[model samples]
Target: MDANEQETDREIVPERLFQSDSNTCASVCGAEQTIRKDFLDMLRERHDIERHTRWYDIKKKFESDPRYRIVDSLYREEYFEDYLHIMKEEKRKERELREQRERERHRERKADRRDRDKDKEKDKDKEKSRKDRGRSRSRDKDRERKSSKEKEKPKEEKGKSEKIKKRETPEEGEHREESDKEERAGSVDSEVARQRENEAEQKQKEREKKLRAEQSIREREKEVQRTLAGHLRDRDKEREHHMREECIGHFTALLTDLVRTPDFTWKEVKRQLRKDHRWELIETLDREDRERKFNEHIDNLMKKKRERFREMLDEISTLQLTSTWKEIRKLIKEDPRYLKYNSDKGEREFRDYIKDKTMTAKTSLRELLQECKFITHKSSDLIKENPNHLKEIQDILKNDKRYLVLDHMEDERNTIVLGFLEELNKRGPPPPPTASESTRRNK
Candidate 1:
């Protein structure tokens, strides 16, 4: 910064030292002139020095000078009211003392007048009471004189009343007039001050009432705005939900159409087609509803699996007696209905179904042994003629089991037949204990 700017920054000006529109330099400079620092300092010293002075002393200072006159009203408001109250109290005391002195002087004057009247009454009694001359004539003359005095008494009293009216002192009357004027002025000033205070209080109350009303209006407006925003939000959410539901209905129709299509006989393959078409549409549902619908769709996908199993059961009895299980399996898969049951879960379900269906058809182990013994009843040389006898028995069992069976992921139901045959081979053919032994036993 430049030096001039720095100097401008450092120079200080204190506020509230003088009122703006004071008439101190009205003709010479301007009413807007600021008080000099020296005058401010002088005022500060004068305030400390004269703070204890009489109110009239400060009033004289204010009334004589134009400069102090402006500050005088401010000073009276700020500090002079206490002194004003004290001066009024002192004036009251002085006036009361002056009235007391006047009352004492009046009392003394009345006492002196009373003493002089009593002395004139004693002298008149001394001069006229002792001698009695020409009693009857004196009595008549005294009566006539008394009548004349009574006739003149009213005029003399009127003259004395006029003299007393003229004797009222001008100084005392002026004092009473001045006192009355001061009393009237004091009452008017007090009334004016009281009215101004009441007006100010009423204005403040109005301002506070207006503020409360405005605040209440603002709060109500904010509440209405929040309520409106909430309603809009709810509307938006409902719109979104409606859109989602419409999309769901459309996707469900597409799935149904895919199931009705003629190609791909397996329900699983049909579902796969539907998935390829609208898989993204199904992802928007909530968790519980989504899982429920997904399971229902899966049921639809595997719908043909049980029908295919029942068909396999019906075909089991018609298979050739010489055919192996692999040959039977090959024939079964060739059917259009078998494709849906080819999946892992479908195949497992089919196997369990077969197990349940064959439960009633299962041959007892004792009955099966007896049947094997009967089949091999002829001789040890029966092997060459019946090389595939175990296969024959297996085909018979396939018929008994209703053909819907699986073992080791293959049609290995014939292994049970082979087990029975191996048991028959280990035990040599039972000897021909025929009729000769029977006859000897009978003798």
Candidate 2:
């Protein structure tokens, strides 16, 4: 009976230990993992090394419903301490994981808030001109954020680790142990901070890249606008050029038709045009454009006159030498041929003919003097000579093409001949021979 009671007490001890193990796990570890820990404690308590090796089988046997019983004293104080150490270690790991998650969330919130602030700052400067905007402002923003973060760090960091360590009785070797643990935690913190910094730098680079892409697109849009403006300017210039040319053509046609009769002089016709409503048509034109049109109009008038003279071809050929220029002029006017030489251009053509004919006649007269070294001919006397002399002079004048057009301008023919004689007088006969020249010639 005594041996059986001892056996019952031993069985009751295992039952109490099982119950205590469950309570310890619930209170400290906060997990259902207490069974595995209890099994380990069982191997430690047992003196059988072979049973310790077969840990899984022992766990299966003890945890089975048939042998299950609680024993409070089965796990000693040392086993409970080991359990406490294990619980502390597991809780520390869980706390570190939770802290990591909280820190990640904190960094994410800070980054998102900073990005929003950056956008707000960008919006504030949107009203400023783009030309005056400085790219240095981005660096300024980065520096400002760094300064504010540093300014707020002491208060924020102090509150973050606000849980104070209890002042307990000192243990001899605990200082080194605590210092090593703190150092490990600091190293982990520094590594996480370095990763956050690297991520921030990557985000900043991405923002700068997006800004550059947007700026390039804006520049291309401006270039396209400038090209369109240039095309518009060219189109306006071309339209103005065509309108100017059309104005000149209309003015010239009007003048050509006006000068087909001798009833009007060009000066009178031009002066009267202002009152004739014809001048009002061109009044809108600029001064230079109107002047260009007038010049073209005179040229058209002269061409018309020249064409009319050519139509009377028979009379021009017949009266070459026989008619005095005065009668030739009258005959040309009344001969039913439309001859009008009353324009400013007609007088201009007359003067030009006179100048060219004089030049040629002078050249020939000078050569004639060279040929007849001591001739007694006087230019004035020759011009007033008889028909025979006039005929002889006419034969000489025919050789040069410059004087040929004078016949076509029959009214100016006498004036041209007189001008030719004046050019000959400008030479003043010939130079009197010098003393050395006379002596050389006599010798």
Candidate 3:
């Protein structure tokens, strides 16, 4: 090969190698992030890791866990903090969503009530209009009858006068009688027509009134049925709630401390529970529900034992927060609470108790800083602009008993104070005045 071709080939090889290396680095980074996420998810599943949990406590608890080894030890603490932040955010969102749904339901119910009231008013107005029309029709029928009666009286008077004249003149009387007969025939036809029209109108009014009555009856029946169904649903829910509570109470009574050991099996507990008469109270519950309640009772017992052990630790005045598990094991080995678990388990609990205390101390110190009136949104910038401002704020905080909790951890205290000031600054200015308030101010 020529020297120029050889050099070109060498250059191409290095470019390919560089591209492959970049791809490999990208893949490695992606895999690392995936495992790190899995480790955080594992920590979330651990019910023992509470809001008060510390990195030291969690590390010892899950050091041997497969998922824990996925992430490097350096990143575990950072991931745990992320997990805590995610939980807090999720809880806040859930609370806000629940409140918003409640408000919407309240508004919907109010609107439904207003619509019902409006419908009732409209129905009352229609009924009143129908009654008024009926009254006016009856008045017109009375006036017609009065006018017909007056016209009949005038015809009768004319007939009397004509009869008297007929006795005097026979030919004239015959002619007058013929004309009266024609007039009477026409009056009879008119009266019959008026009677038929009145009958038809009365029948139409009666049919309409009957139809209205039937419709009202049907509507009432529907309303009654809806109310009855709602009552039945509420009753059923109440009964279910009461029965669930009774079942839980029965389980709590049956599962005593002696029966709910770490090695306790569901089979043995079921056999023992069935023999007792109190089991009848919870017999209606499904098998899965019964087992779940049984497991919950056992967990409660374990939690109470852990609390009692922590209480024992708190009562010991000689032990320091920084004491090692080996040192703590020697101090509480003879205690009954300590003996409740194995040596390793007891050490884990001691570590958790110490972390809990540290978390509580840090929380107290933060609260003290928040309550300090001298601290403001601009406090962080002010401290930077004037160094002595930091000391002055610290001296003010020193007077409070809560500040003494983290008095030895100067760096942590300063970090918390600065972090809080930064948070306040991030909040920006207060909200604008509401429209109603603005209107009131103008007035």
TM-scores of all models?
0.33, 0.36, 0.42
The candidate maximizing lDDT is 3
**Which regions of candidate 2 are displaced past 4 Å?**
1-172, 253-284, 306-314, 317-324, 327-333, 336-443
Lowest lDDT block of 10, candidate 3 = 254-263
Question: Residue 225 lDDT in model 3?
Answer: 100
Per-residue C-alpha lDDT of model 3 across residues 97-134, encoded as one tens digit per residue: 99999999999999999999999999999999999999
Model 2: how far residue 289 lies from native, Å = 1.5
lDDT score, residue 34, model 2? Answer: 65
Rank the candidate models, highest lDDT first.
3, 2, 1
Model 2 Cα lDDT, one tens digit per residue, 185-232: 999999999999999999999999999999999999999999999999
Better of 1 and 2 by TM-score: 2
User: Would you list the rank order by TM-score, best first?
Assistant: 3, 2, 1
lDDT of 1 by residue, 22-136 (tens): 4344643543233332223334445433334444434554455444555535444344554445556767899999999999999999999999999999888766664444566
RMSD of each: 46.6, 47.4, 33.1
TM-score of 2: 0.36
